[model samples]
Target: MITAIVHIDVEADRIPEVAAQVAELPGVTEAYSTTGDVDIIAVVRVAQHDMLADVIADRVSKVSGVVRTRTYIAFQAYSQHDLEAAFALGLDD
Candidate 1:
């Protein structure tokens, strides 16, 4: 799966509305309102890289009040689920 972390900039008064709309888009796993330079952070999961443009450029970027977006493709992911499973391989407990 291709994992995309999208940082969104939106109109000041429409952050929540924009985030809610983005969260409902296809392949969008989650959208969160956050602090700092970006207003929303959207997590997208897709089958391939080309789909990133379709999702981010065509869908996310066009959402109402979304001024712009920047996307980062994840090369590696580290999570507790992966760590726990690896550590439990030969352990009795």
Candidate 2:
């Protein structure tokens, strides 16, 4: 799966509305309202690289109140479980 983390900026009054709208789009796994440089963070997962453009530029970017967006393509995913497993590779216990 291809995962894209999208940082979204929206009109000041439309944060919730924008987040809800983005969350409903195809390929969007989740959309969160957050406190930071951006208003919303959307997680998008797709099967093909070209689907990114369809989801981000074509769908997400066109949502009402969406001012701008910055998308990050995930190269690797690390979790606490994965970290522990890696560290235990050569251990006896």
Candidate 3:
């Protein structure tokens, strides 16, 4: 699986709406409104590298109120145990 951490910038008042839309996308595992340089952060999982672009362009970019996005694709994962722990905690849906 290819994992992506997408940082999204949206209009302040539209943060919740944008986050809800993003979270409903097929490849998006989680989306949260945050207080930082970016308004929302989304985690996406794609079966292939090529599919990542589709998820970003078709799903993420199409969300209303989203101004911009920066996608960070994970290169090397360190520990499966950490991932498992996160899942066990119900962090990733």
Candidate 4:
């Protein structure tokens, strides 16, 4: 599986609508409105890397208020609780 974190820039007032659209896409596991350089953050999981671009172009970018996007591919991920447990045992080092 491939995981992508997509940062979306949308019209300020339309963030909620855009976020709702993002959440409905097939590959999107989660989407949320956030404060930063981008107005929304979406998590996309796909069966192949090439499909990632298709999801971004066909689904995410097609949303009414979306203006731009920056995608980050995740190499590894850990829950905060796992990280804390590892740190407490000095396993992270």
Candidate 5:
């Protein structure tokens, strides 16, 4: 799966409305109203890279009250348990 973090900016009065709309999009897993430079953060998962444009450009950007968006693609993930799991699986300490 291809995962992306989309930071969304929306009309000040439409944060909740825009977040709800974005969350309903096919590829979006979740959307949150956040406190920071961006108003909302959306997690999007797609089967292919090209689908990103379809979900973000062709759809998300057109949502009513959405001002703009910035997308960041994830390359890897690390967690506290990853090391423990690797060790248990026989990785040499």
Candidate 6:
């Protein structure tokens, strides 16, 4: 699966509306309203790489209140257990 982390900016009054709209898109698995430089964060997952443009460009960017978006493609995913094991590797007693 291909995963993308999208940081979205939206009109001040439309954060909730835009988040909901983004979450409903086909490839978007989750959308959250957040505090910081960006107003919303969306998690997009698709079976193929080419589908990213279709989801992010064709769908997400067109949401009514979306002002802008920055996308990050994930190269690897590490679980909490994986992180712990890696850290413990050199600490064996």
Best TM-score goes to which candidate? 1
* Greater-lDDT candidate between 1 and 5: 1
Specify the poorest-scoring 10-residue window by lDDT in model 6.
Answer: 84-93
lDDT of 2 by residue, 50-89 (tens): 9999999999999999999999999999899989999999
The lDDT for every candidate, in the order shown, is: 0.95, 0.96, 0.91, 0.91, 0.94, 0.95
lDDT assessment of candidate 4: 0.91
- Number of clashing residue pairs in every model? 0, 0, 0, 0, 0, 0
- Winner of 1 and 6 under TM-score: 1
Q: Mind giving the per-residue lDDT tens digits that candidate 6 earns over 25-91?
A: 9999999999889999999999999999999999999999999999999999989998988889978
Q: Residue 51 deviation, candidate 3, in Å?
A: 0.6
Residue range with the least summed lDDT across 10 consecutive positions in model 4: 84-93
Among these predicted structures, which one has the highest lDDT?
Answer: 2
Q: Could you tell which candidate, 4 or 5, scores higher by lDDT?
A: 5
1-93, model 1: which lDDT tens digit per residue? 999999999999999899999999998999999999899999999999999989999999999899989899999989999999999998996
Of the two candidates 2 and 6, the one with more favorable lDDT, higher being better, is 2
Candidate 4, superposed: residue stretches over 4 Å from native = 80-93
Give the better candidate number (4 or 6) by TM-score.
6
Clashes of 5: 0
Worst 10 residues of 5 by lDDT: 84-93
In order of appearance, the predictions have TM-scores of 0.91, 0.86, 0.82, 0.82, 0.85, 0.85
Error of 3 at 62 (Å): 1.2
Ranking by lDDT: 2, 6, 1, 5, 4, 3
Name every residue pair that clashes in candidate 5. Answer: none
lDDT accuracy of residue 71 in candidate 4:
92
* Tens digit of per-residue lDDT, candidate 4, span 9-79: 99999999899989999999999898768799999999999999799988899899999998999998879
Which residue pairs in candidate 1 collide?
Answer: none
Candidate 5, residue 52: Cα displacement in angstroms equals: 0.2
Q: In terms of TM-score, how similar is model 1 to the real structure?
A: 0.91
